[model samples]
Target: MNTTITSNGLPVLPQAKGNQNAQAQASQPATEAAPAAKADDSVKLTESARALTAAQGDKAPAIDTKRVEQIRAAIADGSYRVDAGKIADGLISMEGQLNGKP
Candidate 1:
């Protein structure tokens, strides 16, 4: 049997006469037949995943709100200072780590 694709990219298959009649009968269900039951979906977590979730609990990582407020206040008063040397050192450290250096 040959398969053809339409302009819309859907695969079109040549159906047999018996198959077409069966599909039509299936489309129009019997009046005595009951409706299909709804299925309940659920997620099953691995042992390691469940353990990690239990360890973390419901709380998120703690943030230094006081330090954040202090930084905001400093910026507002034009007293905030940027340590270029410290930033450069950190970048150099990251590069060294990425290169597999101690």
Candidate 2:
């Protein structure tokens, strides 16, 4: 009886002549496969992202006075508490959604 051992100490079955030939063919370089094609279009940025990049190092647009007053009132009345965990979770969720994995 013939016996074979693998690198991991596992017992290997002896291959028949036809099985060996098949394995050799399988191991040969696959000439039929073609290289991946390059993308024709360049990657695109969102309109908002492009605008933000264009506005980099410039002063941001002025906020509306009514909106600012409302925010100030909310903060003064203790109704504007910051939830760090919620903000973090929201940012993480938004990132996952943007990455197309959500």
Candidate 3:
């Protein structure tokens, strides 16, 4: 049996071919088999996966352009007033949501 030294300098132990095995396998020369063909590699997505990919591609932006334009116009006309109480309420609600509270 041939032994090869590993990276840590320890010799690799050969697999035990016990005498209990059938004689035919033992008599045969140990030859390497051909590796699998790389060109045959292929991908197959399920119907749900394809639908999900299409749905992701078809997604719309979360920001509403019309509302944004309105807000921008209000700010430019000096009519945009900051409601501190409303902003504080929104922040508290957000904190509650983040902390998993109702």
The models' CA-based lDDT, in order, is 0.61, 0.59, 0.61
Give the per-residue lDDT of model 3 (tens digit) for 1-102: 955333364433323234224553454445443343354556799999888777888484477979977876665554556789999999999999999997
Worst 10 residues of 3 by lDDT: 11-20
Candidate 3 has a TM-score of 0.37
| lDDT value, candidate 3, whole model | 0.61
Q: What tens digits encode model 2's per-residue C-alpha lDDT throughout 15-90?
A: 3234445555554433332222333525689999888977874666665989866766655444555679999999
* TM-score to native of every candidate shown: 0.41, 0.28, 0.37
Q: Report the C-alpha lDDT of model 1 over 1-102, residue by residue, as the tens digit.
A: 955333364434433234345545554434332222233534699999889877988764667979977876665554567889999999999999999997
Top candidate by TM-score = 1
Q: What is the lDDT of residue 51 in candidate 1?
A: 91
What would the C-alpha RMSD of candidate 2 be, to one decimal place?
A: 23.4
- Which portions of model 2 miss their true places by more than 4 Å? 1-72
Ranking by lDDT: 1, 3, 2
